[model samples]
Target: MARKGGELEAFIAFLGGLLAAGLAALAMAGIGLAVRPTPALKSAALVTLGAIWLTVTTTVYLRIKPRSS
Candidate 1:
């Protein structure tokens, strides 16, 4: 049905966006390591960034409209 097709399209788009954001977050974490020379600081920064990214992605995915269908 048309509704199912639309839902599928929205789901696919959501997945694509999630993938892109994940990649970007990883790149940012890698860059963060270079910004902080101390090992402790680097670890902390990466962990914080990872946690924030996971939280944001989960929230966005949950709020995606297609799933409501």
Candidate 2:
């Protein structure tokens, strides 16, 4: 039977987006770190920000799930 999308799917999507963003940030960090010492700070900042966002995303997902029957 077909099923309507639910919070789980939303959570999964949110996680995927977070992961993609983190990967992009990491790549940028690598490139930046390669360029100059100043960019290294930006690199660390972005990676940390991305990790924080990922943690928030997971927390939100836990909040969204309803109690199981």
Candidate 3:
């Protein structure tokens, strides 16, 4: 069975992408932190990865489905 469309589906998809990207970014951060164990550098890496992931994922989603309204 598939989920019905409407706002809920879009919202869920958006959240899923964000969560996926966030997790990816966190994993990268963990690797960096493990190697150097630095606060600033780790923060930066996480932020950069998360931003990139979010941007790319959102862009892809938008391309797949434009504005709902």
User: Each model's TM-score, in the order given?
Assistant: 0.47, 0.47, 0.49
Q: Top model by TM-score, which number?
A: 3
Cα error, candidate 2, residue 29 (Å) = 16
What's the count of clashing pairs in each model shown? Answer: 0, 0, 0
lDDT for each residue of candidate 2 in 1-69, tens digit (9 for 90 to 100): 555556675677588658767777787668776776475777777777677677767666666655454
Question: Local distance difference test, per candidate?
Answer: 0.62, 0.69, 0.68
**In lDDT terms, which candidate is top?**
2
Tens-digit lDDT string for candidate 1 (1-69): 435434655565566556756776787678776785577866776676566656655565556545543
What's the lDDT for residue 57 in model 2? 71
Task: Note the residue pairs that clash in candidate 2.
Answer: none
In model 1, where do residues sit more than 4 Å from their true spots?
A: 1-5, 37-69
What TM-score, to 2 decimals, does candidate 1 have?
A: 0.47
Candidate 3 segments whose C-alpha is farther than 4 A from its true place: 1-9, 66-69
